[model samples]
Target: MNMSTTSTFPQTDGVMTPRRVAGAYLAEIRSECLRYLRNPGFMLPLMLFPAVFYLMFGVLMNHGHADAARYLLASYGVFGVMGPGLFGFGASLALERDGGLLTLKRALPMPPGAYLLGKMAMAMVVSGLVMVLMLLLGVFAAHVPLSGAQILGLLALGVFGVLPFCALGMFVGTLIKGQGAPGLLNLVYLPMAFLSGLWFPLSAMPSWLAAIAPVWPSYHLNIIAQRVVGLSDAPVLAHVWILLGVAVGLLWLASRRLRRHG
Candidate 1:
């Protein structure tokens, strides 16, 4: 008896279907981000919050701390970038999960990777725009006094720092019911920002604040930015490690949650 070998061949339906699903996800994300942009009132508040916080803490009410502008710029930049990650992506994830979007995706034949990949891509794009807004506020409006290299470094800290928090936000969205999402998100974002000293340098705050600062994701994120803005020549390995660890941990948790839900 001769055994017949199956020849490898491309499946037409397989190709088009996944492509269309991925495309649709992309389109949906773009639509969501653009909706925020179209209404400046919503996005503008996010842009202004960090700047206001920086000014209120680091300038107008500062107690003559060392390098206030530079330090505050970095901190606010961290807080600024995280807005899109938490508020933006959190809301998106909440809406999708609550509306049975992710559940629906479970029935589809497309690769599961596309669901997450599309969200991450969307998050990056939206966060990038918010970063630009924060950068302008830090530089021109706030007068943070940073160099070109420092500027780029802050951007890295801002963008890279969002990853873990975004993952965490997604996980949170998964856990909470829809009606409680917005309030729950605010509860997390506001306290974490203050606790992390995004409004003031931990050094100037209570010593206990500094001790607890590292535990908040914003602390490590801002630490890198502070070094970049104020101590541009300092080694950043430690800060980078912190961001990576947070991102990895959150991502792992988010992945597990997604699998369980699916």
Candidate 2:
């Protein structure tokens, strides 16, 4: 559907229930995604983070063990995709909520799905860009070679990698205040990355630290990404399903929170 077609959404119980205006939703999604693009603040870290990890663990420090470079190249690539899902999505949602825009938007005839779908679309867009940058580093600088099929497979892995985090981000946004979102996300991001075996293998951590790895989505995502990149023996589809399950559970929790507060 083109943007020009105006569909009149019928009111249900004195409120117009938003039907999906594909074009309108797409436009809004694009606009929402563009918000980050206009500001260069987010770009620098996303572009540099993989390289930073590469340099720190891959070359200079060499703390990741023998296959550290390859392992980190894939691991950081997955983490790069996740950073946007967690940080950007949470930041935007919390800001809109505290600004009272979500309330205003809810009063409109727009579909309830639009808000969420917009977030998902924005997450996908941002994560896709982040993955591209990370992959470029892997190919050009990190000395990791990926074939055409592997690239396609990597895209699938990246998408699945972000889904659960996107759900958690939504949940986090609902729970945290706007002004505190940046700090809250950072708190969650760094700890989760460290504990979930993203920075290094679970085996390398202390026993207590290793004990917590099973509870995290990032751990599962790491294994899944490893499988996708041909680095592990785990079944790729199973982990993707597990990640989907986690996303679905978080989305449900977010729904409950939104309804309770709405």
Candidate 3:
């Protein structure tokens, strides 16, 4: 009877193996990537806005100033990353939540982290494409000279820097309705860009206003990008820690809100 039962049931654990879990996670990431790529409204703005701005300000109106071109290259790179991180997490998640998508996803047998991580992976992919396009424009059109190391460093920072913005977006998504997310994101995105000096130098602003530069994550990110391009000498580790702290805190808040609502 025991042998017959074993033969019928099979001698195996019910839990998924690590490889199976990883496959599922990767599948989720692929789905997220495809979803974002298929949406022209999302993809177009994300790809074009930064490129066009770089062309107009960094290349065309750069006024024979090589330094200006290089500086804008770094600054616009920061600007490039912000769009994917903010809108990807904020607007997308809010829409999903309001449309009952998240509820449906939750009912699936997949791991919860898969969903969040998939979204993050998608953002990273989009952010990476933006970085590549910006760098290409900087090299070919703007003629901004950068060392191989500097280019690599800027790319790395651009990818990693999406975290704090994702956290901020998640927090915003959890708090607002889907319909309001795009408007709210624009309100946050543009002000933060202008205030953080992504469009211009903070030093050009009033001293009091410049003092608030450190208050924005984008400012810190720009500082790091500048350091990569020999534009700033600020302490790098301090900026890294500040971003880490902000990401952690915002993620905590977002998780709490999700729990309450879920």
Off by over 4 Å in 3: 1-14
Give a tens-digit lDDT track for model 2, residues 1-262: 6655587654555643245456668777887778777777876675577668866776567653546666776788777877878876777778888998889988876655877887787777777777776677667766676788877777766665787888888889889867899789889888988898888878899999899787888888888777767778867677777888999999999889988985
Task: Report residue 113 deviation for candidate 3 (angstroms).
Answer: 0.6
Candidate 3's residue-wise lDDT over 1-262, tens digit each? 4546444764575688889989999999999999999999999998898899999999888789998898899998999999998999999889999999999988888876898999999998899889999999999998888899998987887788888999999889998977999999999998999999999898788888799888999998998888998877878999999999999999999989998996
Model 1 per-residue lDDT tens digits across residues 1-262: 6465578565674556656876877775676556666766557767788767776876677665647666776777778777777766676677777888777877866455666655665566656666776678667765666678877776666656678778777777777756577778888988998889887557678898789887887877776676777755567688778777877787788778767874
Candidate 1 global TM-score: 0.81
Which of the two candidates, 2 or 3, achieves a greater lDDT against the reference? 3
Q: Each prediction's TM-score against the native?
A: 0.81, 0.86, 0.94
Report every candidate's CA lDDT.
0.71, 0.77, 0.90
* Candidate 2: stretches off by over 4 Å: 1-20, 59-66
- Clash pairs, candidate 1, are none
In candidate 3, the residue pairs with backbone N, CA or C atoms under 3 Å apart (3 or more residues apart, or in different chains) clash, namely none
Candidate 1 regions off by >4 Å? 1-11, 16-32, 35-42, 58-66, 232-234
For model 3, what is the error of residue 162's alpha carbon versus the real structure, in angstroms, after optimal superposition? 0.8
Please give the lDDT score for candidate 3.
Answer: 0.90
Winner by lDDT between candidate 3 and candidate 1: 3
